[model samples]
Target: MSALPGLDDCVHCGLCLPVCPTYAIDRRESQNPRGRIAALRAIEEGRSAPTPGLLRGLDDCLVCRACESACPSGISMEGLMMEHRSRTSDARSDGRTVAERWFLRAVVSSPGVLDRFLGVARLGRSLLPAALLPDTPGPSRLRPARAASPPAATSRLSTETKGRAVLLRGCIADRVQDRETRLAARLLSHFGFEVSISAPGCCGALQRHSGLVDLARELSLERARDLLSGEPDAIVVDSAGCGSALHEPLSDAPELHAVAERGTDTPSLLATIGLPPPPHPIPGPVVFAPPCHQSHGTRSTEATRSLLEHITEGEVVLLPGEEQCCGAAGTYFLRRPAKSRQLGERAKERWERGGRVKTLATGNPGCLLRWESLLRREPGVEVAHPVTLAARAYGLESEER
Candidate 1:
């Protein structure tokens, strides 16, 4: 009981209950944060075993941390959930758990394997529509293989140069988000920053979100060390989930914690140093889905809005139920496709109301993919990262680096 976060601090005020998606679905006490914490306490205190019912209750949680925003006691629900999962998750208990574990530990976390895996997915998408497949992550993004380096473009600044920065190319993102990664690099370079791509790697977000803490810790430490090796002034990750995960205290290792502190999202870092007024305006109205990680975890919504407002001509509308999870809670959709779709239906509802909007921008890759999957039938609507939109507005894709 003492080992779990928020166990001792919980006031049981039930502020988190209404925001919990699983609880909303089940309406069971077992599905909410307070109930989950009680289960953790019972298990830790040896008053109850981690039985299938209790474990299932915990497993059903999205870990989206939607509840954290409502907590008055300042409880770290994600921290408690991750720690609980780290100790209790049993891979051998069932085949589903085993497969999910294998995919994250063996496939999604390995850059080479992830690329090949996505290669197979891209092949699959070539045969049929990716929208028919719930698990394939934004198949449209896997463009023909190209050079990873940013084009050598001239900077507008002559004397006021920004310091060097690194862009983390994530595990699955190495393939799926390659263009966004390149666009981000191109934009950062165009913005007067000397940017370098972090070597292909996993930030352990998928793993950590799934409760595989030890491996997440190891992977985070390694990636953090690698990101820091170049001595860059900033490590800008365009992926919200990855940026938020970078700050996760996956391990108690001081070095890992130190390296984690330097990671920031493109908008947050860009907002700090500022940018030249965007020469081109994003066409038409834009609808934005701020990722739960950004809104609830890092609290970078203002910075994200500041950067969005810089490049757009029209209103950047927030999706309805902005507090809700997209159900892409790292590979959660893969495990529970129907429930994931249920969770993501809110975005679709808002998309229907967002008439005349061509671009649906989001900060996180998962949310982008989620929106892509949810709104695929509306081919006219383009789903993109905010940085991708910013990069396009700057015409960086056409300019030579």
Candidate 2:
């Protein structure tokens, strides 16, 4: 039995338990960070193969990385999880479904195919079963065709300009959250920076989390080649999950390492450029739900919070348990419906208890879709990306151009 790298870093500390969403909800040993590591260690020691129970324990994890943020030993929980998943054959079967695999391979990799499939889904939604369709608003409501155009570049600087940035329009994000991408581009333009939307492709984050490391590597290299072709000051990501994935160092692809080093999230990018005063005051209270990837993965909680508070009309109220996963840890809700619902409902209840808010802003697309699905019954509440709200406040036009 060979020892796994980073497996011994855990000192059996229980500090990660309280912050782990699965452990907090299920109170099971295998659901927490330490337990999972211990289970991996057992496998490393040749005590157990990748049994169904072991795979289930690993699959149930959200991989939110909150445990890493809370760990005193600085264990890279995210890397450990990804490494274990990649090494275990049964892990892939446990993490993703057939439909998910097909979508990731066929649709996510090709923008034209995804757009056509979304068009068909939109048209046939009424005839299809409720479970088959997206619980949040339809594609038409989320992304208008005209909204896909890049925002008019504001900077006089050429493509070689110092402040020029590229926006990663990820596969699903490109199709579902097109408005957020557009808004982010416009917001960056408003700050006097040239923004270019990257080519349509998966950031490979989903594939990596699903244990398809080879596929993830291919996608990552493809993205790196495309994005690096146009040397920009920064590569900005609107989705927190994609941003976190992009930040990961790819040893096999040294060019990808450079790209990751230059990657930045939308909130952090906006904050770094200095948020301009809102052109008009927002009418009602604004609540922020920091996505787990942003809060824990990128450690940008303060940056996102400060940006929202600075631009919102009044005090920006952070949703209680902002550190906890929203259960939408990149399709975790789809795979484990019950546990996902439990966590999402818990978050919804927290927001409900905080009174009514006109708008609820979050950093990741998964978080946005999950919150929208949970709060669909509630009227007069809007779920949006923080950059969308900032774009609105700046009076930047988001209509189809």
Candidate 3:
């Protein structure tokens, strides 16, 4: 075996140490980025073998790829982790991996099933055991359809509604997201574009992240065909993780390259088309938590940050752990609730120390839901996505029928 390509990219500068969520939580060398890289190198060189401890370390990883952002050498921790899991897929220690695989295929692979499953999960959340289900999603966790006081001034976007846009509502996204989905469509249409927002199958992100490479690849193709069928000028994704997955072109399907070529996060598109300053109605002291995939995958949260700051009149506060994962690395929260909660708490504590904020916003479904669960008890805080805020800035929310 090639022993996982790109293990040699680490210079051991230790920058990934502070940004790593698992490393920060467990304080384990074997769980850090460089440590994992070193372990793989040793295994390849025959100096070490896959022991129980080694496997356990890898299992604890969130694979959020914050290390990639912190790395000076541009080492892709996301790619490395996926490849490592694929190589060891057969040797998985427990049947839990099997259940995860089945869930991805049987339930999540289809848009319809995923919706029903999430619905049931939310309703029966209290009934489910802690180990199987993580935090209970508070009613306010998902962005409620509340519009801020109507914008004082009409927001400006391109007045010409000409281009076509296709919004890929990733499997779990449409069900849980409100502002990003309903508001995203309205925002795009308000921007003078013909927006297509509808049901969508998996993007293979969860599958690929879970080490089902072949399945992920297949799903990617299906998503490509569906996304491009509309001949969209822009394929927009409100979910950070789904958008990040399509950032890389699918080499196997040459036609699917357009999926990556045109696929963009909503903020990126809005920023590119020239987002004029919208009314700043959001109360001061708002915090923005950059989604792990949004920041790490794009390698910059500037577009989202810049747009957010402009909307809030530079009142946006960068969360202390803004660059760190929110502990919802896909399905990690569901399976490893304890670890996920602890990591979320670390970020929460750091956030609270800086003083309370009136609103908190993040761009991914997992991160949004996680925040809702974490901050449920804390009153007077609104958690939302930029699209929702954008809608308020543009006065679309008041126009809602």
Candidate 4:
């Protein structure tokens, strides 16, 4: 046997039953942790090699970390899944034209370069004919819900607040919704945090998941040291994927303890600060579509919904199972647009079953972009970050303060 780490962690107590999105979607044992563990065990025993079928079971997983959250034995499904991805078959496209390879490499390595590229992409989007835009380019740069000014600097923090935090302004999130990052900063400061953007670039989660394990570790160690050098208490990350990746331990660099101690998701941090929920309840009826990563991986759904409920008077409507993935699956939407769209459409229909949906709240930018693309044809549907809705309801500025 290959002796996979944590292989014996699964007690098979079925504690993760409710949190498995694939299992929820299909109601099959094969799609849940139990089956996944079996598959891994088989591979370890050389009973079944890492064939396409085995890869599909692993790949189809949203890696939301929900299973681990529900595991009573403290089983680390997320870690296992990441290890599997890191060792899996190379799934990249065969004919990566020079431009494609260069673009991916450049963006993964350098945040400044990616931001510049996004700026050009946005300019092209503005200038090109609507029909000419690729069906699904990378990610969107447009801010959702079209709101007000976001926070500007540390000066916005009151003199009473003395602690400093490093805000890991994500490459993808910054490109799509810089406003969201600003709002996050403002909220952090409002809770007595002095926030600063210290790191120079992307977290490389996307590249790492796309079979660039070495590159991911390199980027992780580099960024870890850069942010750690500032000696901040914590690193506030608005992007779920990036934050999750940041929280992960880097085996390659044992000395980088800063990244391990300080990294936390925006919602979790907000909840940690004991920020009271909004005084006013949301007025309209809405569906809270927790991102797969946030709900499953980070398990921040309660904090997210609790925070939203405090801000608006709207009635929060959760789906039947509540743990099912919305299907965006990060870049999976781009790689498997057809399957992604199918999943998104289904989620939308569920959200709008009896009547109209005033809003759909999600934690990840990718989910927001996916919802926008899926419902672009359907008028009156609005997808926004939970914090954006909270900010609007509380009369907080959308732009930098």
TM-score of decoy 4 = 0.80
The lDDT of each candidate is 0.78, 0.76, 0.76, 0.66
Return the top candidate by lDDT.
Answer: 1
Please give the RMSD of candidate 3 to the true structure: 4.4
For lDDT, candidate 1 versus 2, the one ahead is 1
Each model's TM-score? Answer: 0.92, 0.90, 0.90, 0.80
lDDT of 4 by residue, 33-152 (tens): 878888888887888987767766766666666777678877777667766766653543434323334555776477667756666777777788656653444335542222223246
Which candidate leads the pack in TM-score?
A: 1
Off by over 4 Å in 4: 8-19, 23-32, 89-106, 116-159, 252-256, 266-282, 398-401
- Whole-model lDDT for model 2 versus the true structure? 0.76
Compared with the true structure, what per-residue lDDT tens digits does model 1 show for residues 247-293?
Answer: 76666887667666777877877787767777787875787788888
**Model 3 stretches astray by more than 4 angstroms:** 126-134, 139-159, 399-401
Candidate 2: clashing pairs of residues:
none
For 1-401, candidate 2 gives per-residue lDDT tens digits of 33566788888879989989999888889999999988898888888887878878877888888998899988877777777876764435433566667677787667778777777766676567656764544545545234345566542322433387889888877766777777778767666677788778887888787666778888888888777877887888878888888888555578788788888877787677565577765655788888888877667778777878877777789887777888888867777878988998788878878775768988787888888888877888898888877767777644423
Clashes of each: 3, 0, 1, 23
**Decoy 3 TM-score against native:** 0.90
